[model samples]
Target chain A: MRIARFDDDRMGVVASDDTVVDITDLLEQYDPLDAADLLPDLITHFDELKSELESRSASGGGKSLDDVDLHSPLARPTKIICMIGNYREGTDRPQQIMDIFFKSPEGISGDGDTVILPPHEASIFHHEAEIALVIGKESKDLSRDDAMDAIFGYTVFNDVSARGLGREGINSFLGKSFDTFAGFGPWISTPDEIGELYDQHITVHVDGELRQDYNTSDIERPIDELLAYISSITTLNPGDVICCGTNHQGLGAMQDGDVVVTSVSGIGSFTLNVRDSDARQWQRGVDEEMAARVRAQGQEAPAQGNGG
Target chain B: MRLVLTADDRIGVQTDNGFVDTSSVFDDIRFRTAKDRMPRVLAVFHERRSQLEELAQSGTAEPMPALQAPVPRPPKLIAAFGNYREGMDGDRQKQDLFLESPESVIGPGGTVVLPAHEATIFHHEAELALIVGKRAKDLPADESALDVLAGYSCGIDVSGRGMGRIGPSRIGKSFDTFTPLGPAIVTTDEIADPQKLQVTLTVNGEPRQNYSTDDMEYSVVEILSYVTGFMTLVPGDVLICGTNHQGLGAMQDGDQISMSIEGIGDLQVSVSDPHNRDWQRGIDEEMAARVRNRAGSR
Candidate 1:
């Protein structure tokens, strides 16, 4: 089943590619405290509501997808855990320690939303395409075997990044957390719906140009182990997102008016317009030079110096 | 007025005598909104401040419920990194900040479970934490910046040293139960001055961090302003002021850690490492010396 949020915080299940069946009425029973609590409430009560949602989807009477404004599937996940260096970036580098970082939950923007580039003196803004895991239930200290069951669904995420802004060329919260920096959705596809999680392709297109192209098979740490390690560090609450790290091979600058579409197979895609009032410019297209540098020297080598 | 949340997620006001459960205010039609009437703290804070104040003033007090973090689930947990001078004569350094996983928060009487990851040491960073009262962005560095503050609380930024030696420190700082905030949120109106407060932390009943907010390189107002310039802050979001590194030390297994800020109450939590790792007890003089040297030079 594909879950979605659209048009003024209304919850729905996407019945078809172009149709969203309204299940917002189904959630009236939960009576969420605030807008932020809506999604979590649905996730919490999903086991009871699942049958009704399926029936409504079968009946199928709702607005066309194009007629509605889509919101991020999860309204306000408490934390967005992002993996660091979880991908090999097409390199032969050894598996390093599995570590994670955070992006502000408020940084989330939905499908077709405008990503406002902060006016900070960032060297460049790049889009890292990856898939995001939506936690199914409250979890902590999860074993690798239990990790698979803890995942509710997967969504396409554009881990929008600001390159070379960290103090002393290191990553900082401010650099990756400007409003709209974390973009995901069209909708979330359940695990059964998104078959072969390890073999799906993730691609990114800026404006009309194809840039990033990678497969989940290249990910250094597989899904279960990654979730297990992160849960050991932090409790994974329902609706919390663990954005699987991206392949930096196709990473390049996203400037004003550029439309970035990040797509993960079976999960669908989300398009966001980049708005940089500063109008800063960089060489357009795939950043192969930096990608090759990462492939050769490793992910840390290219991150050493400030970017242009 | 001080606000507290019970273990069952009820909001209440903690006064001199006891806790006055205010979670029922939402049930009153007059306080109910067309949108939300849920018994959540953020909802109450956003919609029923005046009523909450009234309850704090005259409502009947009852025994406090099993306690929890005052802000059970903040939308954000932003912290200032290295924003304090080591001592009175210490040189001021540039302001830096980072975001910690809000999921890391545990309430008073909670335990800080050190993750199994290998680390040189885990240190407790006691600092003044401000509870944002409203939605704010692009705030300026002036007295008006304080207008956005709802209250203050004691925050312990449990940090893991040497885990991120080659990358960002966020990895080391974001382990579950790393941020312990609470006891209660002493409303801004109750605190005379935010800058002139004493911030201190002790482990196993021994003093480890003792300092004043006055030595901060960037004051609370400036930190709020600087942070808002980039990210929007909402009600119940915690903005922790940086800590003084003078008496910084290690936190380990079976250690009782207590932290307090003047005006706000005390927050005590225990540390337990499943790995049972051990580090030298008391102030880490080598780390303190490094902090002091940097304080003087930079």
Candidate 2:
């Protein structure tokens, strides 16, 4: 099944060309929270939603894909671990392979969303078009085959970066992790129908001319080997998104209004615009926590007082 | 006032009382991702840095309740000292201490629960907090200057005051609640001059110390510039500019702390019992179980 977060950032799955239906309604029909997990339970509930979508599609009572805004496929992942430089042509050193790094979940942006480009950022920002997977079950020390089985599906990711961010070398995590720096989506593809992850063709473009064009098979260490290497170092939680880095063709500076597209074979493409900057303006996430802690602290909250 | 937070397994928001309703707040920055409700929440302080603080002083402002504080353990927290002449009262010269290698840091509402060991006394140091909002390396531009500041909140450096002449005790400072923050973030727009704001700290209702941001050895901009030379700062990161001096003394269980910065707001927290199994009982039980298992196997 092709899974997506669409229709005003609500849950849905896309079928054929014209039909995009909210799985959340189907989720309400069965259990309130099951459809949100996006794995086992979400995959398991597909039969019910499919039958409903089929009926709804026949009646044309649901939303078409064009009607709503699309968000990055996952709501909030456990973690986002991107390899620093995994491309064959990135560098010539083996020890340099799999330089693991993290980006906060807040950086994710979706199709057609504007990705701000700050003039202060010096390094080239690249559109990394690579086959990436979403973990299904919690995994540790996964065997090569086990790692393959653990992949629930695949998606397109920009691995949006500041090329010069890491050159100074004291701390690259900051450079790679700016607010709204990452772009992914259209949808998540299930592993069953997708072919071997190592053979997909990835293409990158600026204004329609091909820039980065490479095959997954060209990856030096391969997916299974890379998984084995990564699993040895960190635990793999479900919903963790790891892009297998970008080929050198994905490099260069991107200015405002540049619509960069990254597409992986069999999955889909993700297009994002470069905005100037998106500074943080948050009240923090404290609704449920606020109520609970207030009662414990002997203070009463307003009826609608969970979130501030 | 309520400040929300989301983390690995939980989300929490602090209010006038304490931490409340943390379940749904995904540990994500609100304004950057939560746009639909930005203007409704106090996130205005984030987008319009200087004008709002000025407006508030001019008495032409909307009524927003006081927000708590917000310091979700940033990806990184780089701290600094110096500026306040009081900074020189410590054993080290204020000149040498201004650049004290980061000894320790704790997040808002996160604990700094002291172990019962005879380590030097652990105490709270409240300072004007600086949160970096963008990727700032060898950076410039003052107009873009305040752009890098994510938001400001009051935070304590929870230091083990007596651990002198030796490396600071990571354990002493790392206690769970030592670094508490998150009533909610005070955006730069809310405070026109973060330097002139007043800061005060109290324990169990007795005022322990007080000072102003104006006494600092270095300005917020200068300090951020100096630190950026050696480090690449990113969004959701923080720096606890050194705190005002207070005489060091022993801390006991159930000590209540109240701290605040003028317009940013105030926070109060208390010491509590640890949530782990009893130390000696846990060790004895494990040893006993191992011996019985060995006998049965034989």
Candidate 3:
């Protein structure tokens, strides 16, 4: 039903005319403690909350979507599990096994937020358009047949990455975990709203130019399989996010002042602006060392690359 | 003062005789009137360190019950990679880092379940842990990185060498119950020097890992400073300093793994097979083939 958290942490639902019906008052009546944090609690009481929201939406008294700022549908997920090398193209490695990694929760930023490009020794930032799932139930050891039921809904995630730092090839955690590296949401779309998730078209655009375009069907492993594999190793709490891997096709780099938009066809879209970080001044010495190393490497510096 | 989280989700403080139910301290008028609002133990230490210390010292004591991971379900759990001398692979000089799943953490007396995958080869790594007390990012030069710490504890970084040998250690070292932390979190005031502490891990009463934090290539302050350069450290976040590889070895099911730091108390955990499990999905013929291929080429 297009549930969202916006404007100073108020829970609401978006209507056909793009107006937001504030459900905070109604939600508090049902359970005050749960109302304080709506997104996570929505996972446990999805049915009840859905019915309550539907009833409230029938009445009026709401605000336009433009009047207020939009926050991430789920802020501070316990974990942001990301799939590495889950797409077939771009590498010669076998696709039989799935590789996974993590992004720190602090890396998350909301829709329309400015993604700070942390100054590093080298500077090559890239945008990865991916389809991400939000867990609805506390899942452990989920089988393939039961995996779909565990998902609360879907959202668009921009897996912002620092390509130069990632070239070390040790691991992607450090390269991908800078603050504001992970961006998602205008709002979450329930699974019922996005029928046949496997066939949805996903795309990424930078400064009005198409960068990444692919169908969910292009993913090496299906959603159910990925969920089953991840849940086997660790428990998936409600509000946890699992970002399905992105295809390497049409991948491109981004720079300061550029606006990047990631969209999933029936679900939704989110836009983020890239800006140079002010915190870089604190690491000038380290940054200078990296610049020196890149300069010594001549024109073949690794910063000139596009994707990981 | 030492703080602990009991198995049933109660906040507690360790006293001279027994444990004190300090959960009530959250409701005290002193904290309420002062607008000191912190949900977890680490946060309390962050916003009101002295007040918390005073409360812990003057609080009532009662008998202790079983304990859980002191800082369970932290927002972030960052670990250093290749930060120790000896037994490390690849470049030994770099300050590599990685993220361990918060869901993998288990409490003292918890069991580290060995997954039933065929390629799994389990190992034990004993290390010291730092509990961050403040929200720090891009640490300023004037600030001492150690000042961001609230307390310290011991953590056993249980790793599976099979998948770790193939790729990054994220998956292999991140199975459920892979990280066992805490009998209790000893306050920073009591620990004179974090680097000089003696650390040891014994399996079935046999010493498998023995080293000093002094042998670490990256000091705790250096690790925190490097980490804060990119990621933000908030209250309740844990930074596990990488382990010394001096006597690393394999662990078997039904073995009691005891990890102890000189100042921090001992944490005892048992190992066992995945309870009533048959086959694992991710670990199959393809995975085995890849591991075999990599091993053969090596």
Candidate 4:
């Protein structure tokens, strides 16, 4: 099922490519006082609510997808964890231990939102396209076998990064946390809708020009392994996001007035407008040199801590 | 005005007589300070200050319940790295800061669960935490960062050492229950000069970190301005001033930790390590010595 939030906190099930069945009334039973609490509450109780949602979706007659402004399906997630260097880009390097970092939850913007490049002296800003996991239940110390059960659905995330920000020892906090930097939407595609999370083609386009074209098969760590490792470190709450890191191959700079579209095969596509007030520029087109340089660096050393 | 959250997650005000459960008082207006409404704390703190004060003055006093972090689950929990000018020569290096998981936050009387991660040591950093009051970004040259202040509180930054020697130090700092903040949020009016405040930390009744915010390399305003340059800080966002590494020491299993700032009241928590990891009982002389030597060399 493809669940979407649109037009001022209204809940709906996308009935077709262009129509959304109103399920906002179905959520009234949850007794949420505010719109911010709606999505998480719905997600937590989705099991019992699934049958009704399916019926309403089948009963069909609702608004056109174009008449309403779509919002991020998950509102107010407590954590937004993003994996770092979890892809190999078809390189022959050895596997490095996995690592993850965080982006401010407030940085999340929905589909069709604007990515405002903050006024900072950044070398360049690049959009990293990756599939993100929306956790279904509170989880901790999850084994790889149980990790897949913790996932509610998947959405495409743009791990927008600011280049030349000196992320060496700082966990890339400032570089990846500008408001509207973590854009994901369109809607969430549940696991049932997306069979086999692997081998799906992930792609990104800037101004109608393809920039990122990679397959999830290039992912260095399997989805379950990534989920299990992160859960061991901290608790994952319902609606929390875990963005699978992207392959750097075909990465490039994003500038003012650029329309960037990101898509994953079964999940559908979402568009974001990039606006840089400073009007600073970088060499356009794919930064193949940087991509090759990153690939040439080989794999990072294995993680040292006993946390793994 | 002092702000607090009860164990039931209701908003309250600490009064001289007792406590005022502000949750019910503000319920008609639909004010919620529950953990679920954490993102809205700053907005409430900013927009309802005067009304909260009035409610505190008139409400029937009741004993406060178990406490929670005043600004629990801030949208951003940014902490300074090596920011104090005392034990470490902070000026010798560039200004740096890192983000900690909001899930790491535990309120007063909470237990700091030391993860089973292998580390050379676990350190306790006591610092004065500033809670942002308004939405701010790229604080203009004409404005004072202090104008954006909401209040202050005591914060304990529980850090794991030796894990991120080759990369980002956040992993060591981002473990669950690594940040303990609270007791109460003392409004800005209660603190005349944040830089003049004293910060101290004790582990199992032993003195560890004791210093004045005066030793900070950058003033509170400077840190706010610098941070706002990177991204927008909305109400209730926490920016913890870095600690003076002097008097910093190791924390181990079953240790009682207490952190106090001059005006913000005391924040006490216990440390629990499942692996029962042990480090030297006194100050971490090795790290202090390293910084001391580095400072002398510079």
Best-performing candidate as measured by DockQ: 1
Model 3 lDDT at residue A11 = 81
> Per candidate, chain B TM-score?
0.91, 0.63, 0.83, 0.92
Model 4 misplacement above 4 A: A16-18, A59-61, A66-68, A166-168, A298-308, B8-10, B18-20, B29-33, B37-42, B58-65, B87-92, B141-144, B164-166, B292-298
Docking class of 3: acceptable
User: Which residue pairs show collisions in model 1?
Assistant: none
Q: What DockQ, between 0 and 1, does each candidate earn?
A: 0.35, 0.03, 0.28, 0.31
User: Model 3 chain B, poorest ten-residue lDDT window?
Assistant: B29-38
Using TM-score, rank the candidates from best to worst: 4, 1, 3, 2
Clashing pairs in 3: none
Worst 10 residues of 2 chain A by lDDT: A299-308
How do the residues B38-155 of candidate 1 rate in per-residue lDDT, one tens digit apiece? 2234534646788777877787888887788877567788988777766646445545677887778888999999887877788889989888878888899998898887788999
What's the true lDDT of residue B143 in model 3? 32
Residue B203 lDDT (model 3): 76
Instruction: Please provide, for model 4 over A1-308, each residue's C-alpha lDDT reduced to its tens digit, 9 standing for 90 to 100.
Output: 88888987898888755578878887787777677667777788898999987777766677888787888887656678988877888788887656777787775678888999987777789989999989999898899999999998999888898866632334345678777888898898889887667878899999999999998888989989988888767778888889999898889999999999999998988999999888888888999887997797555664343110
Rate residue A105 of model 1 by lDDT: 79
**TM-score of model 3 (first chain only):** 0.83
Can you write out model 3's per-residue Cα lDDT over A1-308, one digit (the tens) per residue?
67788887788887655788887775555453332356776667777777877766655457887786888887777689998746654334345456588888885788889998876764566688899999999899999999999998898998887755631535545778888888999888888778788888898877777767888876778999999989988889888999998776666666767788889997888889888754332211113343333234322322111100
User: Which portions of model 2 show Cα errors greater than 4 Å?
Assistant: A28-68, A75-78, A90-97, A121-123, A139-145, A165-167, A171-173, A225-236, A275-308, B1-298
Mind giving the per-residue lDDT tens digits that candidate 2 earns over A1-308?
67778755467666665456666655554443322344334544554555664565444434677786777787655456666456555334333323455554554678888876654444455455667778776676678877777677788888766544421212324445555677888788887556766778888776676666777766766677767655644456567776776665435445566777878887878788876553322222222332233224212321110000
What is the RMSD of candidate 2? 16.6
2 versus 3: better lDDT goes to: 3
